[model samples]
Target: MLCVGLDPDQQKFPLSLQGQANAIFTFCRYIVDATADLVCAFKPQIAYFASARAEDQLEKLISYIHRHYPHIPVILDAKRGDIGSTASQYAIEAFERYQADAVTVNPYMGFDSMEPYLSYAGKGVIVLCRTSNPGGSDIQFLPTTDGSGEVMSVYERVAKSAATKWNTNGQMCLVVGATFPEEIAKVREIVGDMPLLIPGIGAQGGDVQATVKAGRNKNLMINSSRAILYASQGEDFAEAARKEALKTRDAINRAR
Candidate 1:
């Protein structure tokens, strides 16, 4: 499934929307309208709204998506991870306050940090595994020995733990980058058919063919952000975004 990332940057918005109070929301609304039919999910990175101090606008944007495109899932990319009470509050913010269908979370603190989110029965809790960013290897690729004395990468351990131990509700997923297709293949092998939120296919230069070949399953959500969202900086911005999204969606399908 194609998951469009609605990460708006004022500096990168179209000229007409640059100085507007609701520029981020307005740009996102048009993009959603243009490509809603082509996507299975919309992921609005919370940092974009938080950076602009427009959390209220973020809420309104999510509400608009729910009202108009209720069938399309909204995955709030907050990557929140914390202790018990704090994690519970974060879960409320992502699932209750914003009313997102799923949320991206960090799992460095172990299963306890993710318990509150997993407890939200119907909602999805996607944990970070092999991230798309370059520096992700710094920690995720470290070697560690499991209880059985078998050595494995940190990301592999996370995949096994999330799939076997933390997936009681069957609402768990992992964020494996498209950039690392080989890692994605390994992760798929470890987790079997669990959904994988694959990022890095667009502006990050991830190979679509490789990602599809390695990560394809019944539940792969391949995402594209700036490459689709900022396809153009003019009046045809939304159309351009749709064109890019269509190409991406088709490319993934062809690869699959």
Candidate 2:
């Protein structure tokens, strides 16, 4: 259930790793090695690496995970949303270049953008349904009609469509924020047992017990980014991260 997010921020890094070369990879490598046994997946938000001009480090980090922790899947949190050739190229970047087991995508661009990723045989394509940000309600909570003239919220429609229509390969999933347990339950009701990539835990103030109670029936990748990554600002950062990851993992299991 635990999916530790590698959202590395140098400003928050321990002094020891702040100015080191390949610091991004080194920071994430420490976290991965420390918590690999405690998590089901690792989600690397590409923006953090890209903003630091460390895409090469991101590549090396993913490769290291695949080589060292073969059982764990890597979910590249790029949230790419494009159509046609552009979407195809993004798919190549995620699956071919990074060799990630799964990738997060923006469904706002509709089915055409998702088709390119779904074209892959075993890779996963996770859609942004109900995000953790408050502004997401501005759009996701709006009422809309499904294909059959059924009235439902936009997020609900996304759940219905992904489960029934877009999941032609059985590899589709949804991104539901853990902050809104009610909406998470609503999505589960709409999608049955489809897996969900849940974020908004830890620093975002989402409760572990409530999140688990809402989505425990299906596979969930409950993520924590800042809280776990910055568990400590000292040389023992990795050890502290492992401890935090263990705490989160145990809490999710207990709730189940």
Candidate 3:
């Protein structure tokens, strides 16, 4: 599945929409309209809207997508994780407040931190595993000993635990970066058929073909952010985005 990330940056938007109050929403709307047919889902990164203090616009954008393209799910890339009570609020924010179909969450605080999200049986709770950032290796690659006296990378452990223990609701998914196809393969092997949300493919320079080869199981959501959203700085931005998105979707299909 192709998941387009609607992470709008004021500095990167087309010149005409840069100073508008609904610039982010407008840009996102065009992108969604252009690629809705080709994508299985849309991911709106919370930080982009929150940073600009445009939560209202974010809500409108999500509502617009739902109202127009009801079939494509929206995964809010919030990466929220906290204690039970706090996690509950975050869960409400992602699933209730924003009405997101799925949310990206951090698992650093362990299972208890994720229980609140897990309680929402109908909503997807995607746990962060091997992230796409450069500093992801600082923690994700560390070796840890499981209770069975077996050693594995922290990400591998998270994958195992998420797949076995925390997936009772069958709504759990893992976020494995496309930048690490080998790790994607490893996580896919550990988790079997569980869905994986793979990012880092576009502007992050992740190899789409390799990512597909390693993570493809017809259960992966390959996301592209800046590459599709900011495909052009001109008025034809939406068309440019569609071209890029179509290319990406076709590439993933071919790789599969």
Q: lDDT for each of the candidates?
A: 0.93, 0.93, 0.93
Per-residue error for 4 in candidate 2, Å, reads 0.7
Model 2 whole-model lDDT (C-alpha atoms)? 0.93
Q: Per-residue CA lDDT of candidate 3, range 64-122, in tens?
A: 99999988899999999889999999999988999999999999999989889878878
lDDT of 2 by residue, 1-256 (tens): 9999999999988888879999889999999999999999999999999999999999999999999999999999999999868999999999999999999999888999899999999999999999999898999999997578888999998898899899998999899999999889999888988999999999988888988888954699999999999999899999999999999998998899
Model 1 RMSD in Å is: 0.8
Candidate 2 residue pairs in backbone clash: none
Number of backbone collisions per candidate: 0, 0, 0
Every model: Cα RMSD to truth: 0.8, 1.1, 0.9
Question: Which lDDT tens digits does candidate 1 get at residues 1-256?
Answer: 8999999988888788878988888999999999999998999999999989999889999999999998999999999999988999999999899999999999899889999998888999999999999999999999999689999999999999998899998999999999999999999999999999999999999998899889855689999999998899887999999999999999988888
Off by over 4 Å in 2: 146-149
Whole-model lDDT, model 1: 0.93
Off by over 4 Å in 3: none
* Candidate 1 ranges with C-alpha deviation above 4 Å: none
> What TM-score would candidate 2 get against the native?
0.98
